[model samples]
Target: MNLFELVEQLFEQYGYLVLLIGLPLDFIALPIPPGNSTLTYTGFLTYKGIVEMVPAFGSAFIGAAIGLTITYILGYKLGMPLIERYGKWLFIKPSLVEKTQVYYNKYGNKLLIICFFIPGVRQFIGCFIGMIRVPYRTVWIYGYTGVAAWVISFFSIGYIFGEQWQYILNVVEHYLKVIFICLACSFLILLVWNRVKREKAKKLSNATRNE
Candidate 1:
């Protein structure tokens, strides 16, 4: 069978086992779309009475938490040396520039909490925080909080909408709307941040020239 067929069959036969395996791999740097798919699949399973909603949520939560923690530790330990040795080799020196440094320097650690909820930044933040050797307890605090919020949000949607496909569709539609709204907000924030940084650089440069 093709890949899609294989996945469909897997979900049909052994959803819980498939989820437990896939989620961890996805979190630990595997190129897999585990996020929405797993949640949606679990909901479908619940609708079919193949799995209990509570059990599915709990298992997925633990799986995600453990998986993310592993990545966080790996990032903390391995990321810095690599970044230091050949950041430019990876085309990331621009982000490692003065502006990002200033942003990190000013934020002074609270960025960890915010970064955990943001999509692309979360992985890098885990690495940066890990490299800095931020306390394990602190990491766990924000990390678990993040996992809890994410799990509760998605699973509840699945559970509440589990009875009918149309209900599930509405739930997914709502999520899509929110995701797009967040995307728009992110774009606007980036635009503003870039503008502010440019103006600050101009002012700093003029002041240095005068001095």
Candidate 2:
């Protein structure tokens, strides 16, 4: 099944169990939107009295922490060695991981906390933080902080609007579309600006060298 159907099925079949499991699994690099749809559904169910909000939010938070810890362990055990041994075979981009490490080194622990809200990279931030050798304590503090933020923000919003779960879902889908379009436009603009700047820089450098 496609992603939308799969998520809907998850909501229908597993509900709280899926949120508990999925939140962690997302941290492990599963391509699931655990941060958004899962939390939204969980909130809806909590309001429906099918699941208690505390258990739902707390379990999800714990699961996310465990998942991130496991990711760090796996990265520590295999991430570097795998790169050294076979990353070339896997179409891996070494610079992305390297840059991520550099950011951790320069910024300290804040980057980890910030990445949790970013849709795609949040999963990898855990692994990258470990591969970059940020202290485990720092990683946990930053990662868990993100989990707490997501759990509290989404779950609380859901609980408060339980009466309008379906309406909220519709609004969310609409917003997702808006978010995607805005991101696309932003990326295109950035790309164009970078290209123009690169060309200008190259001309200036060449002129300086000629003199």
- Candidate 1 positional error at 94, Å: 10
Task: Give all candidates' CA lDDT scores.
Answer: 0.64, 0.71
Q: Which candidate is the best by TM-score?
A: 2
Which sections of candidate 1 miss by over 4 Å? 1-15, 31-33, 94-125, 163-211
**Pairs that clash in candidate 2:** none
Q: For candidate 1, lDDT tens digit of each residue in 1-211?
A: 7643465577678766666776666565562654555565566566667677777877777877776778778867787677777877877663454345455545535545544344455445555666656677876777677776666655565556665644665566566567657855975697598899999999999999999
Over 4 Å off in model 2, which ranges?
1-16, 31-35, 89-99, 166-211
Q: Provide the RMSD of all predictions against the true structure, rounded to 1 decimal.
A: 4.8, 5.2
What local lDDT score does residue 155 receive in model 2, on the 0 to 100 scale? 72
Query: For each candidate, how many residue pairs have backbone atoms clashing (under 3 Å)?
Result: 1, 0
Per-residue lDDT value at 86 in model 2? 80
Residue 161, model 1: lDDT of: 67
- Clashing residue pairs, backbone N/CA/C < 3 A, model 1: 76-130
